[model samples]
Target: MDRRKSLKIIGGSAIGIAGLVLADWKWQLADQLTHKGFFTFNEENLISSIVDTFIPEGLPPKVPSPDAKPLGGLSTGTDKFLYRLFEHCYEKETQDIVKTQLVNLDERSKSEFGKPFYRLPQGDREKLLISFENSEIEDEVNFFKLMKSQTIMGFTTVKEVMENYRGYKVAPGYFKGCVDMPSQA
Candidate 1:
């Protein structure tokens, strides 16, 4: 299949969860993610690296990666992109899910590879995520579901992917109300 087709498939299919909480209007809490007190840079970088792993900057199988821009993934700011979604969009219980998932992933990586998730080689990182995606382990399953959804959401917003793959119009004309025109007698 073509690159755009692949992007659509990936974006549409990754959101495997039933009731995702994505609030477009309530983005104010996103600012808190960048704070040092509540959120450290180390955490953000780790999350970002995981996002990058989910969709890496390389040719897939036999398909050539886009030469113009990095097709999708962390180059689009997905590393810290889910901060708002977790902090604001998700309910308290769901927020706990996010935290628990990240921590579990870090621990798993260290236990398996003797290094942090971000420090692993790309192949190993992908293998770990793939294992989680297919694993029956409760925490792994939960993290995969959440990360896949958020990563796909962030991937589609990357400028190149939005325009080239999804056809997002950055400068579309203004919206006007559909008013009934006076009927001709």
Candidate 2:
């Protein structure tokens, strides 16, 4: 080929490659933005529903303290906490299993109850979760167990629960080693 023809071909190939790379980069950025955390919006909503079912709203205080608020998973942001935990701490395989199981749970609810898991009544939701507890499928059983434990962990670790329910003290006063003991009457 002539020098000018060879140059034209080389320039065209480089431009095409650059364009492809730019397109791929833009696609990756959009994907990352849409999936900000480990879960998508719908998956996060499913998690919120599942956690709420595990720890429903308006639970009366265990000790009836005046400052105790009605405890619930959603109110404590347990779903978000779980999301961060899975995103940062869990293995990729575990995260994929949990995500798949969440979708499966919704599909199961629709198959059996004619509605999505999140839309089911509170009692129905409980019954469905209990069914998972009794499920013979290993994935179903594992998913249920993981979700239950994580929900409890997330709920108990929240600031509200730590302060109001558990009476967690940040600093328990100064120590004094030379105090005189009072005599018992």
Candidate 3:
């Protein structure tokens, strides 16, 4: 074979290898973005929908608002929180327990309350959510708690919550702690 032809083949091989590597890296990144922990895209969407509904827009200026960014949304804090949830909670069997409890809750709600979680009215949803919050289900080890924690953390950490809802001052340390009041007449 000619030396030029040999060089051409080597160059083509290197380019092909580089392309494959790049493609693989892109695929992995996209996969990680879509699937974090026990939440697939569909499950993530469902959870996001519920979260958005639970903590919808229009908060009074003073209370921290809920996190509205979906799993795929941009937020390093959220991404890290989610990855940890899956690693610490889901891999540790918390996710399985949560899934079972959710399924049981679905059956009970349909039989006793006549509505699926996603189908319930706003008030009913709130009621069920409160009940769920107070129940033994909270004791279970699963991805659910981790997922909830991440959501809450994200919501509270968001800029909107900090500035608009939580009433963050631009500079709060100017005031000294335990100021003495002047004598009043």
Task: RMSD for all candidates, in order, please.
Answer: 18.6, 13.3, 11.5
Question: TM-scores for all candidates?
Answer: 0.63, 0.72, 0.45
Candidate 1, residues 41-144, lDDT tens digits: the string is 55666677778877787543433344654444766666656766676677887767667777777788899999988888889888888888899887778878
lDDT of each: 0.72, 0.88, 0.58
Which residue pairs in model 3 clash with each other? 67-155, 94-141, 94-142, 94-143, 95-142, 95-143
Shift in Å, residue 96, candidate 2: 1.1
Better of 1 and 2 by lDDT: 2
Q: Native-vs-model 1 lDDT?
A: 0.72
For candidate 1, what is the total of clashing residue pairs?
1
Off by over 4 Å in 2: 1-36, 63-67, 175-185
- Predicted candidate 2 versus true structure: per-residue lDDT over 34-117, tens digit per residue: 766558866887888999899998855374476656779998889889889888999998999999999988998999999988
Model 3's alpha-carbon lDDT is: 0.58
lDDT of 3 by residue, 1-185 (tens): 59999999999999999999999999988986777555555344345444544455443443443754332223324444444455465544656654555565456557767866656665765665556666665553333454466667866776655666567877887967899989999
**Which is the leading candidate under TM-score?**
2
